[model samples]
Target chain A: MPIGFRAFALAGTLFAATLPAFSGTLDEVRKRGNLVCGVSMGLLGFSEQKPDGSWTGFDVDFCRALAAVIFDDPKKVTFQPLSALDRFDALKAGKIDILSRNSTWTLEREAGLGLLFAGVNFYDGQGFMIRRDNKAVSALELNRTRVCVQAGTTNAQGASEFFSTNSITAELKTFPDGPSTLRGFETGECDVMTADNSGLFAERLRLARASEAVILPDIVSKEPLGPVVRNDDVRWYTLVRWVNFALINAEELGVTSSNVTEAKRSTKPDVRRFVGVDGADLGPKLGVTADWAARAVAAVGNYGEIYDRNVGSKSRLGIPRGLNQLWTEGGILYAPPIR
Target chain B: MMVSAYPALLIRVGIPAILVLLLGGCGTTIDEGVVTPGALTERPATIRNEQLIGKWGVASYRDEKDRKRVEAQARAQCRLPYIIAKGPSDGVMMHLADDAKLYELRIKGGSDGKTYLGPEAPPGEWQDREILSVTDREMIMRFVDPEVHGRYGTFIYVRCPG
Candidate 1:
């Protein structure tokens, strides 16, 4: 066979193999040489740009975890900052390999749109906030309160449901994005600003005084956030999904980036299998080398490490591992068996 | 001639004291007598004077100034487990199920799809006995009591969706 004929044959085979995933992210990503992941524009603990332009956050860590499984180096990932409205379209167009922002898992987003959620990275809900000066103890007390929310998010719809459900009528103020919504809240232009609990903490750090605002106790909706990829990419989906599982499992196994290499020497079978030390070869099962899990573990430790480092009790964001804790630890962090 | 461990000693002692002084007010005041990881665990979460967390910047409310505003910046300042999915006695819950961990009243961002730290009220010597309620977007709490200043005060917050 001539070299030209051989090259042509290879290209034809590649195309045929990916016919189902054509115009999808699986092919484009492999061709591009890097996995492009969509992240929040700048939410501090979930996905935010460091002053040096590097990305950091729980969501960012998930992206790196996915990259590690693919390229054997988590840093192979290229982060793309996407706004709340643009994240979905970017993934739909194959502009990004995955959407790992703190986006909620909703029925409309899952089925209505051409997207699929891998797993819930964070379990959050919606609530209200007000000034301490106001004696408004509850969302029920606001007879004529003005609410500020994002225009296209579930927050918009949830706000409508909350007020109507409680028979409380008030003004609804929608904004273009998170920053403007926060600014409006700061300037006293809106009474309540609504979004994810994680975003609220990051936004609050920008305030002149951290005491003026108060969150209310009314979780009107559920926001189970996770990574999203275009539909019909089982290879990419399994790779991404398992990488997340690895993180959560790592956390459960107590293997952190700072100490996983040392801990890999453990004699425990589960530990050996998890860190690729034992005969367990789970990585090759996912289209990567058997050491894929090890590479991910080395690069980012486990889910607990990622959470604690990114949004857990020790980071600047310093959120506790509440519902995100492993099921063994009494939280809801269950994953499929590695076997 | 001025080279000495004396300067090093001063740096070692002075730096920490300054750090203590500056950060002292940021957290709850302590005895200034003992410190340890165990001690840190024993200390209760606290919110200090006028230093505010972000406001719940979602809805429209008429203020005394008659200013109609949306609450967007309501946020959390203290470390978590303040409002939790599990109980403090249980430490950190590993399962996503243990809502029994009432670390937060309800620190959530409401459906408008806003993400916020719902609400959390940790018990303290100078804290509120009842953390009233918690939601995903905001918190309603009261300190010890009107006489105690640690009761009957609520904190509402909203998290920005990243």
Candidate 2:
């Protein structure tokens, strides 16, 4: 065989060898008496540690929703905070059952890493942030400027594509992680910083002089962040995917935590189906209790509630629900029917 | 539209008495703490244009985390003044000096017998707020859609008499 073919064959063998030696992650989670969730070390609104050392944010709520469905208790889960470099490793090595970190779902990550992205929870894109005093309205004006970016991230590729397409040549100051990258930009090591728009907003809060910087209007690349699970765990993958869809469907159907009990009594066919009051066996299909979706909603509320609380207009980030809103509301978020 | 019919039925039964009470032209005030007889239902109260036509300042805007950073930004921008003006139809228009476009909102009666200020577009397009109290000196509003915008809680606006 040719060299290229030999290399491909070897990679295929390695991939097959790395497939989970054990089946049914759900079973293991049950035996352990708690689900292990992997999350970011700290990113405000998405996932962050409170003063009391408790976890909170959009991503954190997702894990709680999963736990609610499985154990009927949102607190029956433990969070293992991991940095960007180790998050995937932790998930692949079985140290975590579900990775609810704000990881971008990409073809390489899903196919190459032998992992599956359940669904996009937060729709994001890359953007730039500069000093407010710069008075630059457009990103094109940043020619010959220095940009602070984290290495080993899509930010590096996105920045390169943006600068090249805009025909601007600037120095790229790279750091190992998010904190160092933000620090470099804060200390004047770079004129601008680039990251997912959501991340830039979160990191801005950590700046000593946060009021001095402004995120630009330009969004250059797509970043659909979601939960990731091991490949071939068909039952587990289906369960995770449906939990996300249930939350989204709850938002569309107006079945919030505060009114879920009332919603269960709704005469609407859609609401009844989602609330498990229409005699649908959705939970049985997913290997959970009959009121799985209802419990999840009661535990963490619906997708809209979670978003508003953690990242939307109601959150410290004040990030608008632009592309994250439901399709009926002019956004791309849509879920298949439960029926 | 189907859900709207319920509110219309409520209006026929409740508005006459409230309108009679407000004929004095002092503007109707609905204290959120006081539950009116009609408040047994969930219909919103109707607000008159006279109550909202004035200049106001931003007192605060809270988020889920209750951080005050964005509120401070809004406060600085309000220094230019926020104005509520009469618009075409029953809709009211607000123009924040810094914003380029006019925001059109409508006052509707809720089952709670409280007036709410919601966007002029279709329902669920944007979050609505109840006019908890509106006076010559101060006005308070609370988000009607708690599931979507409740983290902001009640927004307080003091009359900017300058």
Candidate 3:
């Protein structure tokens, strides 16, 4: 019976890890002593693990930001690499505290699956990438083009919809995953490839000649990518949402990791409150600490810092802050005020 | 104390203004005082005396390429640190970091605590940028073009060190 009891306990722990996000994800994450974040399986600028076993990328930094708020240490995050298909199931089953993978926040995923999208961290859209010499100026110009699309993704459906809507005949070559799709595209199995524009850019680099491929400026569908938590825990949801907003607002307020120390000492009332120097106790309300936002910025920098370093002009992905920018800016990335 | 209420007031005032402009538009002439979001009715010939007349450091930016690398590229191009300046008659002049190529941008202020900056053109001639925030040392702005907005969000610029 000694071994039997141990076996059951181990099984219970494993089972608990896969349960739905219910009750207190906060308490569970705290007790476990680390925040488990579900990330994509190495999407270059979005989330990738270096040879040193340390993770870096936009999504990875987001998790680190969350961990910094919770534990005051970005290293406290455990990045669990998940595939696009499995990422949501992982979050839903409580295998991860947060889903930082570049997941599209869809109505079905949110309202139907009991998951809540905190906010769009990255606003992406489906687009077509083709050979620059192909002379197709727009998606409409892509008539009768052979397209490579990944299977089991919205990109496949989107490609089909675009072709149909535009009344263009398309030969869609479906691949099992991103790498395969890129391989197909690289080998000229298809004349065009479709995915979230960011993914297309990431995949383009894997090709033999990156410059040969050009992502069409036209975008077809809206893909509001962001972190997701279960709807069961409103407090946890609020905290996660605010963490993203904090990063965004921090950037808008001109707070960067390098200047966060100076920002904390800012005489401006807005800066003081934003940096948690003179704000009402907010951490306690989120089941963390009042200085949680400060810690997060100190660890991972602001949203723009994270963006530039990972996906924006700094990283190889070099995705623009288009619709992802704040509403005040030309982009639609408007976050509610922290107060 | 009232300074803290600016954002909320902006939303309150800006929303109605935007709705009114949107609904009233069918081909209204610029002379009707149609206060569109980025369409300034009064176009100045020179930068003159505007609030945006100084060097601004690039705090953050986003585009189709890596922002930090772009910044580094810009730094390599500039004689001084990356900065946007407002010169008389030339509007706001921003120097590209690497080539130090100067771009003259037109700028105007709104009653809603917002500013517009873009190419040197008459009011409503071209899509101007919307400067969302500007303080003693900080400036946050974005292009007013929906296409550009859909591509790169707003940019945050800090006042350059003296």
The number of the candidate with the highest TM-score is 3
> Taking the tens digit of each residue's C-alpha lDDT, what string does model 3 give over A69-114?
8888899988999987888776766667899988888889988887
lDDT per residue, candidate 1, A19-45, as tens digits? Answer: 443433444555666778899887767
Runs in model 2 with CA error above 4 Å? A1-23, A51-53, A133-146, A151-153, A168-191, B1-162
TM-score of each: 0.57, 0.59, 0.60
- Cα RMSDs, all models: 23.8, 20.2, 21.7
Candidate 2 C-alpha error for residue B107, in Å: 42
Comparing 2 and 3 by DockQ, which wins? 2
DockQ of 1: 0.01
lDDT on C-alpha atoms for all candidate structures: 0.62, 0.78, 0.74
Question: Relative to the unseen true structure, what is the C-alpha lDDT of residue A204 in candidate 3, on a scale of 0 to 100?
Answer: 83
lDDT of 3 by residue, B59-138 (tens): 44566466556445443433455445655565667632223566776666544545566555544332566666667755
